[model samples]
Target: MTELRNPVIRGFAPDPSLVRVGDLYYLANSSFEWFPTIPIHRSRDLAHWEYAGHVEGAAPGGSLAGVPDSGGIWAPSLSWDGERFWVVYSIVRSVGTPYFDADTYVSTAPDVSGPWSPPRRVPSHGFDPALHHEEGRLWLLNLQNDHRPGGRRFAGIVATELDRETLTPVGTTHLLLQHDRLVEGPKLLKRNGWYVLVLAEGGTGFEHGVRVARSRNLTGPYELDERPLMTARDDPEWPLQKAGHAELVETPEGEWFLSHLAARPLKTPEGPRCPLGRETAIQAVTWDAEGWPRLRQGNARPTITVEVPDAEPPAFWGAGNCARSPHPPAPDNAPPYYTLRSPAAPSWTDPTSRPGRLRLRGHHGPDSLWSHHLLARRITEHHTEAQVTLQANPTTFTQSAGLLLWYNTAAYYALDLTWAEPEGEAQHGQQWQHTGRTVLALTTRDENETRRAAVQEVDADTPLTLGVTVHRAEAQFWYLTDGTRTPVGPALDFTRLSDDHGTRLRFTGAMAAIHAVDLVDASFTADFTDFRVICTSV
Candidate 1:
C-alpha cells in the first residue's frame, strides 16, 4: 500500500476545485489579490501534485489592482467539456459588505497553461461559482450571497442553465436548495440513479465540514445527509484542521477521492494562527449501500495518510493533454515564483537581464495593493531560511530594495539595501544632501508599528548578502559583513505575520519576497542572484 500525505498541495492554496481528464488530474484554487490568478495544478496519483500553470488573463483587465486584501479572485471553478477547458470565477472588489461588488467571468483554453480566451462577464449571483456539464447542456452552480444589512449571507445554492455556445445563462435561475445551516461550495455529480450534490457546510473556520444532498432532478427539493462526509473541525488538536470546500473525482481504475482545503495552525500566546494558510488535501472516499459518498462508514474525519491504487505511468502522462508535466517527481512547471497585484511584469522582474540574475525594478512599496513591484513565494514551513545576494546602490533614501517576509500591508518585515546619511550629517530632500553611505537595514512591521536596525557605511560596490532564518515561531534577520555573520534586527515574533493575528480575515500565507521601491522616482534597479530558500523543519 502506498501512503499519501494529507495536504497534496501546500501553502496558501484554498477552495480547491478538482477535475480529472483522461489519466491526468487538474486542480484550481482561489488567488485573491495576488497575481497569476487561478493557479492550476497537475497530478496523476491523487496524493502528489505540482503547479501546472495559471489561467492567463483570468482577470479581464490584466490587473487586479486596487482590490483589497482577500478580495480579488475568489474560488475559481476549473472544468472541462469533451473538447476545450472551461474556467469560471468571481472577481471580488469588496469583502463582508452589503454590496459584495463581485463580478463573475468565464474563460476557455485549448490547454491548461493557456492562450486562454478573454474572460466574458456572467451574471454575478455570488462567489464560489462552478460550472456543471451534462448530456448536451451546461449549468452554473453558485452560492447566493445576500449582502443586505440583515440577511442570511449564505442564502442557499442556485443553478442556471447556460447556452453551450456562448456560455451564458439561457433562462431563469433556479434556487436548488435553501438550508438553515451555513452551506456553500456546491459541486454536482450523477451516480447510479441519484444526482449527488456535495457542499461545504459551516463557516471556513474550526467549524468547517463537508456535507452532501441528493435529488433525482437537477433542480428540485434536495435532502441533506444526516452525517458529514469529511471534516477535522471537531478535532482541534488534529494535524489537519478546518477541512472543507471539497470537490470529488473518480479515477479511471474505479477509485474515489475528495479534494478539499485544510490548514495547519500554530499555537501562539494570543491564539492559534495558521501561518502557512489553507492548503489542498485529498481524502479517499467510499460509497455506501444508500448511494451517499463518504470518506468513512461511521464517522467522517480527514486522515493524515491514505493508501492509493498503484498504477504504471501512461504515454500521455506528461504529454499533449497534460500540457507541461513537472507533475510531482519534477519541480512544478510553474516555477517556484509569483508576483502580487498584477502578473509578474517583464519590465519589473527581468530574469533574463543578466545570466542567472533577477533584476527587480521598484514601483510601489509593500503597502500598495495595486502595483507592487514584488516577486515572492509562499512560506510553507515554520522553520525555514530565505536569503538573497543583492547588488544595488541606492542614491537616495526613497529608493530601496531587499528581502521581505510579508503577510499583508499591515503585517510584514523587510531587510533592504539603501543609502543613509552619516550621524550628524544633515540633508534636505535631494538637494543640499550630505554625502551618505550604503546601508543594509532590517525593518519589521507589526500592524502600524515599524522598527528598523541599520548597518550604514557598508561597501557600495561589492554585493551584499541578506538573510532571514526562522525556527519555531521566531525569525531573525542577518547580513554577511566582512566575512562575518552579523545579526541585524532583534528576533521577531513570526506568529505576528499570521492570518488570525491580522485585523481582517486573511486567506493567504506569509510569503518570502524580494522587491525594490523608489518612492522618489522609481528609477533605481536592483540585481539579485543566488536566491535560495530551504525548509529545515517541515
Candidate 2:
C-alpha cells in the first residue's frame, strides 16, 4: 500500500494547487506581495519535495516597496496540458482600502525548471484564476468579487472560455455559482461526466470550510453538496479551524489526495496562538461507491508525520552549512521583510553579502509591528531556531538595535540592546536622559502580557553576538559577548505561540527580522554575521 505524507510543503505555503505530469508532480502556492510570486515545487514520490522555480520575479520598480507584513501573492493554481505547464495567481497590494484586485496572470514553461516567459495578464475580472482545458479549448474559473450595490464581500464563482493558443478570453464570462456567503479559492474538476466546483467559504477563519457544487455543463446551473467536504469541527481537540483552500491530484498509482492549509495552535491547554501563520497539510482522498469523495478516517486530524517512499542514494540535495561561505539561496516568491505595526519605511537588508547584515532605521517605542523599517522573513515551521550578530553603539538610552519575531501590529517578541548613561550622570549631570550604552533587553506581546515584557533588564554587550531559539516546545533568548555567555533572567514562555485557531497572530507566520528604533539621532546598524536553522531529524 502507498502512504501519503503530511505537510508536503512547509512554512507560509498557503492556497496550494498541484498537478502531475507523467511520473513527476509539481505544486504552487500563494506568494502575496513579495516578488517572484508563485513558487513551484517538484516531487517524484508524494513525500520528498524540492523547490522547482518561481513564476514571476519581484514586481517592476518594487511596486510592493514599503508595504510589508503579509499582502502579496494570493491563491495560485497550476495546470498542465499535454504540451506546457501554466501557473495563475492574484496580487493584492494591502489589507485595506480596495483590499484586493482580481488580476489573473499566466506564464508557461516547457518544463518546471526553465527560462520561464514573462507573465501575461489574462484579460479577466476575477481572483484565484484556475485553468481547465477540455477538448481543444481552455476554460478559466475564478472567484468573482461582489461589487453590486449593497452586495456582500465575495459573492460567487465565474467561468469563461479562453482561446487555447493565447489563453485570452474568447467570449463573455458566465456566472458558474453564487452563494452570498460562499467565496474565494474556487477550483473546478470533472469526474464521471460531471463538472465539480470546489470553494472555501466563511472567510478563512475558525468557521472556514470546503464546499462543493456539481453541474452537467461547464456553464453551471449547479447543485450544492448537502455537506461540506472538510471543516475545522472535524476534531474538537485539534484547534485548527479553517481547513479549506484545497487542490486535488491523482498519484502515480491512481490513488488521490487533497492539499490544503491547516493551522495548529502554539499552546495546547490555553490554546496558544500560532507565531508562523497558516501552514500546508495533506490527506489521502478516496471516492465512495457513489462517486462522491470522502477523506479516510482514524479519528482523522492534521499531523506533522506523513509516510512516503525513502530517498534514493546520492540524493543530490542542495548544500551550504554554517561557518562556510554562505551560498545564495533563491529568493522566495513571497515577501522577505519582517514588519512592525507602524507605517515606517522599508528596512535595508543585504541578502547577497556573506553572512549578510540587516540595517534597520531607528524608531520610537515598542509599537513597531505596524510600520517600521525592519528586515524580516516569514516563519513557517513548528520547531525552528535562528541566530545573528548585532553591532551598534547606543549613544542614547532611547537609541537601540536588535532582533525580533513580528506578527502584524498586535503580537511579537524581540531581544535588543540599549546603551548605559555616561559616567557621573547619576548625580552630577542635570536631568536623566536615555543613553545607548548597550544594555540587553527582551520584549514580548502575548495574551498574558499584551504589550509588556515578561522579562526586561540591563546586561553586558561587549561582544555583540545574539541568538533567538524557537523549539517546538519553547522559545529562548540568549546573547554572547567576546564568545562568553551572558545570562538574562529566564527563558520566556513560548507555549502560546501558534495559529491553532488562527486568532492571536492573525497571520500564522514568523520571520528573522532586525530593527533599530527610538535612537538618539545617530545611525545604528545591526550586522547579522551568522544565521542558521537546524531542522529536527526526521
Please, what are the lDDT tens digits per residue for candidate 1 over residues 268-359?
88877787778888888889988888784356778878877665423333321112222221222223466777877654434354666778
Q: Which tens-of-lDDT digit does each residue in 1-538 have in candidate 2?
A: 3354455555566777888898787888776643345667776776656667666442433345434345655788889989998777765554543335545677778986656667777754557788887877788888776555676557678888888767777889998888856667888888889888878766665666777788999897988777777777556557554578877787767677677787665555565455555667776677777666666553234445545443332232453221110112444312233333322232354444422555556765545323355655555455666666776656555677777665543456778776554444453322244442346767776643554343344444443676777776466777775576664545655544444423432443555566677644536554455445443422
Q: lDDT (CA) for every model shown?
A: 0.80, 0.61
Which candidate ranks first by TM-score, i.e. highest? Answer: 1
When superposed on Cα atoms, how far off is each prediction in RMSD?
3.6, 5.5
Candidate 1 off by > 4 Å: 313-335, 348-352, 424-432, 453-457
